[model samples]
Target: MDFGQIINLSLGYIFSPVTIAYALAAVGLAVHFGYAGLLNFGMAGFMAIGAYGYAISILSFGLPWWVGILIGCVGAMIFAFILGIPTLRLRADYLAIVTIAAAEIVRLLFTTQVFDEYTNSADGLGGYHAGFRGANPFPPGTYGFGPFTYSADQLWVRVFGLVLLGIAVYLVWALMRSPWGRVLKGIREDEDAVRSLGKNIFAYKMQALMIGGVFGALGGVVFALPSAVVPAVYQTSLTFFIWTILLLGGAATVFGPVVGAVIFWVLMAFLDAFLPALAAVGVLPITSIQAATLRFILVGVALMLIVIFRPQGIFGNKRELTFVK
Candidate 1:
């Protein structure tokens, strides 16, 4: 086992563009489940819509990349409104069921052969990044050191992803500090109490949903930036991964999701490299094939331990734990 390689690999994931995308999604989720008392199990749907909307707009309509992004954001907001209107008034479980089903429906719709002309019917879209890459400022060469190195295009994606993530974090932080944020927190703590004050709980919840859903959409666009927008990438498992990042970082903290995303990917990368190295050395009883799956098993155990010993998460305040089920 090369310890240096493992360390470098882990560090690489800590700053990965994909990790930044997940962090953005988890931050949006932190607003939904952590601060607004909403259970949105269909985050993947927002992502899928964002990615597909952006891709289709650029590919089918010949729209500029920025215009496609705006369209994607608007599309996600509309989806949020549609999802939240009927379900936000109901119990959280109802929202959860609707959201999860809605996400699956969206995924299936993209995969359906009827939309082959638009969506390519699960084959997904590519060759649409030319305009996006045209904006890259980096020269055509490799950057970074050792395992952390990246080509010019890859470096542009990382820089762009980090910039977007920083903007998202700042936006969420500013929102949470405003009067609107106070209402969200109040609703999260006690909806009846907030309603008693004559506040429109449903409106607030819907607003939060839209805000978070937009964030998820932006994340989806970022996730698809380096490659095509594949429907399979927006499965329930993606939402679950975002949830894990949220929990791992501290659900209620502003920076928790960002930290959680970095940690989650870094640890996963480390385990992926380390377990295979161990298998090769015969230090572990498992074969390389089993090691691939076993890394997740180890990660699951670690998550279980985190939940048991520090349910509030690494950076979460104890008071925030009250909001969680």
Candidate 2:
């Protein structure tokens, strides 16, 4: 079954850019749902704005890679403001509905032909890597050992992703320890009480939305670093996957999203490798394709189990966080 090969492939995801991307997005979700009790279901839209903003700026406007990233962040914050202005004062469920609809709208807009000159419509955007690659300090050589080994380009992306993740983690950790964070938690627990205490609940929610949306946008930038910016990649399923990661780890905890992303991707990588191998060896009666599909079913079951048995997640305090509230 080539067990050794499977192990190496699965373990390599520990430092994968994809994992870092998801981790970054999940952390943003944590800010929305975990600490602030905001039901934001349009994170995919934020990511798309980030990826396309960065790519389009570089390709069409001749901007620097760093400026493209800044544009992406600003784009996401603008999106958050647009979404939050009318909805943040409404029920949480309303925010969810608006977000999901808004996300789909964003995707369709990118898929439409009107913006083809910039977005390229459904064909997506690429070839914006030159500036980013030019900034890579690593020489042309392989680095690391075992499952962690990678060429200079690969190493550069991973290192950059890790640095961004670290900064995000620190920012979230620091914010959660301050007065503003306490107000956010209070709003999450009981908005009416916070309002009674003279807090501007709407403003807090807007700020949180913008901050988290920026994080999600950064995640999109990372997701596109090693690949092209395809509109199809920002579907609703991506938001659900980030939610799963957030729930799997302690949603409210600073490091929970990071831990959750690592575990979820590692398990996915393992299943992706092992399931096909098992089917090939006749260990599983299903075909290789079916075997691959089963992994998602298993993940769905795992998510249900986590929600039912431990809604607070691995690092979440039961009293501080729960899906039932």
Candidate 3:
């Protein structure tokens, strides 16, 4: 087994655009469940809208990159509004049920043959990143150290993702520090109290949903920066993965998502690399394919341990974990 390759792969996740995208999505979750106490289980739906909306606008409608992003954001906000309207006034579990169903609906809609002209159905949409690449400022060349080198376009995408992540972290930090954020937290802790104080609890929940959905949408866009907008990529597991990262870092902390994303990907890379090597050396009684599946099992065990011993997460407070009555 090439240990050097394993280390390189693990380290590469530090600057990966995918990691940044998940971090951004997890940040949105932090705002929803961690701050507003909204149970939004269909986060993947927001991401799907973001990715599909942007790609469809670009490929089918011939919209520019920025316009495509705007369309996606609008789509996510609309979805949030629609989902929140009927369920936000109810218990948190209702929102969770509705959101998860809505997410599945969105994914299945995109997979239907009726919209294949635009959505490409199950195959998904691609070849829409030309405008994004055209806007790249970096000169044409490879950059970075051994095993970390990336071409000009790849580097541009990573840099762009980093900037977005930074903006998201700062925005969450600032929002959580404001009066509006305090009210959101109050809602999270005790919605009845905030409602008794004359604040429109329903409206606040709706606003929180919209904000978090927008962040998830932005995350989807960033995630699709280097790949096609595939419906399969926005499955329920994606939401669970984001939740893992959110809780792993610190659900309510500003930088927890970022830190958690780095750690999660690094550990994933290391295990993915090491397990296959062990299998190859006959120490493990599994094929390479089975080894790939085992990584998640290991990750699940680790997450179980974290949940049992440190329910507050790495950077979260015990109070933050008290989302229940």
Candidate 4:
């Protein structure tokens, strides 16, 4: 393997659009599990709804791309509320079970033969993003230094993604500092105490879930921008990756999830490059295929170590954690 190829490949993730999307999704998750104490195992579902909603709207309705995106956001909020309201009052495990099942249900629905006319099922949606890419401002040229570079479209996407990321971080920072955020923290600490203080605990929880789901949905839309709306992309594995990033960066902190997302993907890319080299050169005995599989195994072990040593995450306050169990 070429050393330059490995370095450049590893560095390519630094400004990856997918990284930004995951960062946004993790930020939303920071609100759900981090501060709101809600267990949303179906974040990927919200994302799928957002992705398909936007694509389908633009494809079928001839709406402006921005309007379609707004439609997607609204759809995600409504979907999250629909999923959250009826389910929030139940036990914590119920939310976990329901959300996870709900996610799969949504994925299947998208891929279901009945909706293929609208959703395109397994083939997914495309040609709708022409309007989106038509707005790119970058002139045709390779940009960036060394391992970090982007084409005109890619650069535009990252710029747009970073803007969204900034807005999300700022919004969460404001929310986490307000009285509403404090009540969320209170609920996380003890819903009973918050209820004793005359607050509507369920209402707050619903709002938290809805808002966080909005973020996830927006992420889904943005995440698919660089790619396509493949229904299979919205799986439990995506949610797991988001959670790992959330936990890694230190949940409950305003910037933790975003930071964690960048770090996690970057590290994963790095390992994907370097580990195979080590194995191939006899630094280790594993083959490239095994090396690839082992990357996730190592990441899982690292996450386990983080949880074992600091359940609150790198930035989370131990006192703010909600142990519903």
Which scores greater on TM-score, model 1 or model 4?
1
Residues 104-124 of candidate 3: C-alpha lDDT, one tens digit per residue: 999999999999899999999
Clashing pairs in model 1, backbone N/Cα/C closer than 3 A? none
Tens-digit lDDT track for model 4 on 31-87?
Answer: 999889888889999889888988998898888888877888888888888887789
- The residue ranges of model 4 lying beyond 4 angstroms of the native Cα positions read none
lDDT of model 2 at residue 224?
98
**Clash-forming residue pairs, model 4:** none
Candidate 3 residues lying further than 4 Å off, grouped into runs, are none
RMSD per candidate (Å) reads: 1.4, 0.8, 1.1, 1.6
Per-model TM against the reference: 0.96, 0.99, 0.98, 0.95
TM-score of candidate 2 to 2 decimals: 0.99
Model 4, 4: alpha-carbon shift in Å? Answer: 3.5
In model 1, how many backbone clashes occur?
0
Cα misplacement distance, residue 33 of candidate 4 (Å): 1.1
* Cα error of candidate 1 at position 30, Å: 0.7
Top-lDDT structure, candidate number: 2
Q: For model 4, what is the error of residue 246's alpha carbon versus the real structure, in angstroms, after optimal superposition?
A: 0.4
The order by descending lDDT is 2, 3, 1, 4
lDDT, each prediction? 0.89, 0.94, 0.89, 0.87
